[model samples]
Target: MNDNAATGEKINQQARAWYVRLGSEQAGADDWHDFTVWLEADPKHIDAYDRVELALLDISPQETKSGVLNNPVGKPEENPSDKIIVLQEKRRLLKPIPRSYLAGIAATFIAALALLFSANIFQSPANIQHYATNIGEYENIVLSDGTRINLNTNTKLSVQMGKKIRAVTLYSGEAYFDIAQDTKRGFIVNVKDTIITDIGTAFSVNFYESTLSVSVAHGIVDMQSPVQKVRLTKGQKAVRLSGAKTMTIASVEIDNISTWRDGVLVFENAPLSSIVPELNRYFKTSIVLMDEQTAALTFSGVLNISDQDKMINSIEALLPVRVMDDGRQILLSGKQ
Candidate 1:
């Protein structure tokens, strides 16, 4: 093995020894101090700790509680031979088992690497990629299972695909999923801890991190959480808290949610306080309203995102306010 690989193997072996010592309360104070000192000595020490933590977590629960390593010493402490016997027996039993587990992890890592290195992985007829737009940027992506995804503004996602299954993880963002229907194989998108399994549905998922908001534009989407699963129809909305696994269903007005897809934002009975942040996201400009009273007032109207001047005029028209522009910053207040 190479030097780095050899070092890693040695660390893994030491970790098991440390774990046993920790379990039996046999690790001396000096040993614990030394380990801590080494851990803080280099960044690689932290990485090694993370790997060992993963392996420990992956170990079978039965193996952990089996009391296999009752003593770090080979035998009972009455004599020197006891320590030798215990040490020898422990090494023999643990060496083979940990190597086997490491081999399995190596195999999975190799397979993933091969798939990534292959030139035709994305070009295959069976695989489709999906992409989406950012704030002021557009994208088109084809998924590994032939699904297309278009995302919009401040989105996050994870992708999983192979011959058998295709999955995407969307934590907080908006995405347009153009699912390619396959009877034998299905595509799924994960939102937080929930899953949106396609039932031949072409739809869009808009998720907000701070608020529990899920707006569905078209098709029947299956949303599954830890406690419950629900099928959402077109023009239906799901809202819940950030930590909540379940969603509350509501009938949504399609225009309000879908308008953002068309470069228009409409605020009906929306507080000026709420509107400022929305405007900040759509435009490169920063908007500040000096009057808290005016910011609290609710405004109802549609604003085409393309025409900033017109949009500003419309907002000012409704409120007794004046807009002053200073570079990219705009201040709105009571007419003065």
Candidate 2:
């Protein structure tokens, strides 16, 4: 690529990063300071930022018909001579702009935004709010719809509330939901091909190793796909294996289930393979099985997460396995 083309591309990327960061509630005074410094670095930087602002506005532009209504045909207004902060503030930007200047910036940013979308550097939908729990972490989230969600370790999801329905797309991992009762509006969770619709319920859904499991503790839930539908009620569980045509429903002891809300993990004849992956979510280091034979071994137990070492020892005692801790990674092999 030519030097100017490469340079413009880099500027656009940097500007987009700054734009996203600044929009977050986590952006603090230091972030704002760094952003202002970056904004003042070069003239091309200003152009790049303007493009970012314009693209963000374009992301949701129903109310502000920014093209024809805001920017009309005219000579570009002269830059203010008195260092006015209202129109072009150092900290708060893109509030008020000269019509002609805004038109030029919007045109340029639209081109850059198209490139960004095509390259896949930006994928967040305008209306969706994203939440995630890092490995070894758990969080309680309250959505705009007044629904409560307990996100387990290594989980990521997005929420979008509408007038008629509340939708969430679980990208990965697990969560327990205390969905608010709304007869006029229903709650839905989209996991792979399965669409979980709630009927005023509290439940948990887990997506692991391409398999989806839904457990209803209270009320009823319907897991629907294009081919089949399964209804689950209190103390009931359903599993949809990857590429399966229908879900298998079973019964669980709701009172004894070790849910994330209580910080307990209950395994019912869970294989070493499944247990190891779940354990990794609560610890910084991972436990790796030495072979597939070790992974196939099954054990049933309730693990208290307060002490991870105790749980590891319990696993080792139940199965004929030895725990080899290497500080960074844990290794499990058959006991001699």
Q: Compared with the true structure, what per-residue lDDT tens digits does model 2 show for residues 42-63?
A: 9899999997788654222111
For model 2, what is the error of residue 93's alpha carbon versus the real structure, in angstroms, after optimal superposition? 52
* Candidate 1, position 280, lDDT: 53
Candidate 2 wrongly placed segments (more than 4 Å):
1-125, 256-258, 291-297, 317-319
Worst 10 residues of 1 by lDDT: 78-87
Q: Against the true structure, what is each candidate's TM-score?
A: 0.54, 0.59
Residue pairs clashing in model 2 are: none
lDDT of each: 0.60, 0.70
Name the lDDT value of residue 248 in candidate 2: 86
